[model samples]
Target: MSVALDGVGFVHANGHRALTGISLSAGAGERLAVIGPSGAGKTTLMRVLGAALHPVEGRVAVLDVDPWKLSPSALRKLRARIATVHQAPPIAPRLRVVTAVLSGRLGEWTLPRAIASLLHPSDIAGAHEALTRVSLQDRLFDRCDRLSGGQLQRVGVARAMYQRPALLLADEPVSALDPTLADATLRELVAQSEATGATFIASLHAVDLALHWFPRIVGMREGRVVFDRPRDEVTQEMLTALYANEHTAQGAADSAVPMHLAVCRA
Candidate 1:
């Protein structure tokens, strides 16, 4: 199965052009990374790919089904085959980590069952297994607000993993963590998704991390795709130029800085 966009364009309600004639495609199990500076339409593009947003122009197809043409129920069914993890953890702060993770299965369960599980999470074993994959099994019962930023992000990943989707869309999944944690979390995410042959499309600001982890990289600038190539074809010079005049390099360097030293400086 593949997700393909043909000349897709989107304009926000506020009149901002979020994407313009952006076209791309990803096959199953492909690890594609979208890299760009802030507000470069990475999120908008990902949303479109995830079927959360419909392009005002052009066409988008996931496994031969036109996303925009689907009925409400059909759209919901299609979405169950794709999962998205946002930059910030979207779990309820007061909810237990296990409950939040188990929520991923809600789409496949009946409303009554989902509501029943909220009282006594239906998939304890599955949730525990997911947490173990992310090395957070010990914190399964912890409140979402109690976990550190890195841990919370892992919880979000666990939730997505429990869905067993065919395609995963992650927006800055590791941006809030320290470098070591970011690398570890990203590795776990990619490994887990690959185990299920799910395609991954992650938007990342750290060019080095994207280069190291993804086979293909797509570069965006001001709502336009400037470059799309394999990792071997992308050079540091190309990345430097793509994010020129922005603080991408500075952000990358900051991620490389030892957290202990950064804390001492703070």
Candidate 2:
């Protein structure tokens, strides 16, 4: 297995419970999409899977090892093999695109090489190659501040692709893109992950996107998983109910199609 979580729970420092009893697993090279409304613990779930947040209780094994159990150095090594493409790519506006992309390997590169690359990127060709996948090759040397929101989002994806990680995780990776870019970007990311034999998981807000690209679908609600089903088995009714709030039972689920349509638009 590439990723597994058992009875996991996380509570914030401010006494807010983020995740509860999240038991999910994905095999090597498998693709899964997690769908839910806001505050469903999807981002927290991604952080936990990427070993950014330690669960207050239960176990997490990523790439066949528990990261929390590993030493600091060992954890860094493990994290190098896992890459997360964030909802908002945390990149400095003044940084060049090449620097941002090359930073993906800083954890693995030697200190001198890393510093030199930061000063003057050592692998412009490789950075260009990755940026080309997202149609950002022309912006390879441009500073990030000049790019639009969607452009920055693609740059983040290029960085992840450049990392060549064994396990790929994304949290709303294409939220800023228009429909066309969103579709194409997801296709490239999914295709690249499959080509590299990397396990891919994404927490998505768009239900149609999830259904179209992923084989397995997981539905989370209020910090818990409401359903986990194969793509072919996930019905419209289930999706409607999953997105339904307390005020929606009598109103939304009665006509599942509209509820689903709204979710897809979202």
Candidate 3:
């Protein structure tokens, strides 16, 4: 398995429980999308799978290594093989786009080389190649501060693609984009994973996008897995049940479509 979680659980420092009793596994080249209403532990689940947050209970293995069991340096090495595209890009405002994209290799480069790349990006061609996939090659030398929120999000995706990790986890990576750009960016991400044989997993708020893009759908609710099914098997009834909540029922109802039609259209 490229990514595995068994009985995983997490709680914030302030004592808010985020996830509980989650178990999942995905092999290389598999595409999975997680969908649910806001605050349904989707982000928490991504953090766990990305090895950014060690589970307080159970285990998480990425590319066959138990992340928490590794030493600090070893953990860094493991994380280099797992790329996480966050909702926020986390790039410095003043950094050049090329420099930001090139940072993807910092984990694999020597300390001196990494520092040098920050001062003068060595792999301009590689950075351009990555940005081209997202249709941002022209902005390669622009300051990150000059970009819009959605553009920054695309830069993040490009960086992850540049890293070429064995496992890719994205937490609402397209949340900042319009429908058109969002669809295009998702196509790029899914294509990259397939072409490289990497496992791709994303948590998205758009039910239609999730249903259309991924073959496997994992529905989450209240910090737990409501259903994990093949796309064809996911029905509107299942979606309604998965997203049913006092405040969000209407919103969920608006998003839910006939699963069979979604597949056909996709």
Q: Whose lDDT is higher: candidate 1's or candidate 2's?
A: 2
lDDT of 2 by residue, 87-197 (tens): 899999999999999998888999999999988899999999999999999998999999999999999999999999999999999999998999899998998898899
lDDT score at residue 161, model 2, on the 0-100 scale: 95
lDDT (Cα, tens digit) per residue for candidate 1, span 1-266: 57999898999999999999898988878888898888899999989988988899988998568987889999888888888888887788999998999888788889999888878988899999999977899998888989988888888889999999888889999877888878887887788677989999999988667766787889898998999987666655666667778885546634433332223120
Model 3: pairs clashing at backbone N, Cα or C within 3 Å: none
Candidate 2 worst ten-residue window by lDDT = 257-266
Count clashing pairs, candidate 1: 0
Report the candidate with higher TM-score, 1 versus 2.
2
What are the per-residue Cα lDDT tens digits for candidate 3 across 102-141? 9987899999999899888999999999999899999999
lDDT of 3 at 128: 99
**Per-prediction tally of clashes:** 0, 0, 0
- Per-prediction TM-score to the true structure, in the order listed: 0.91, 0.92, 0.95
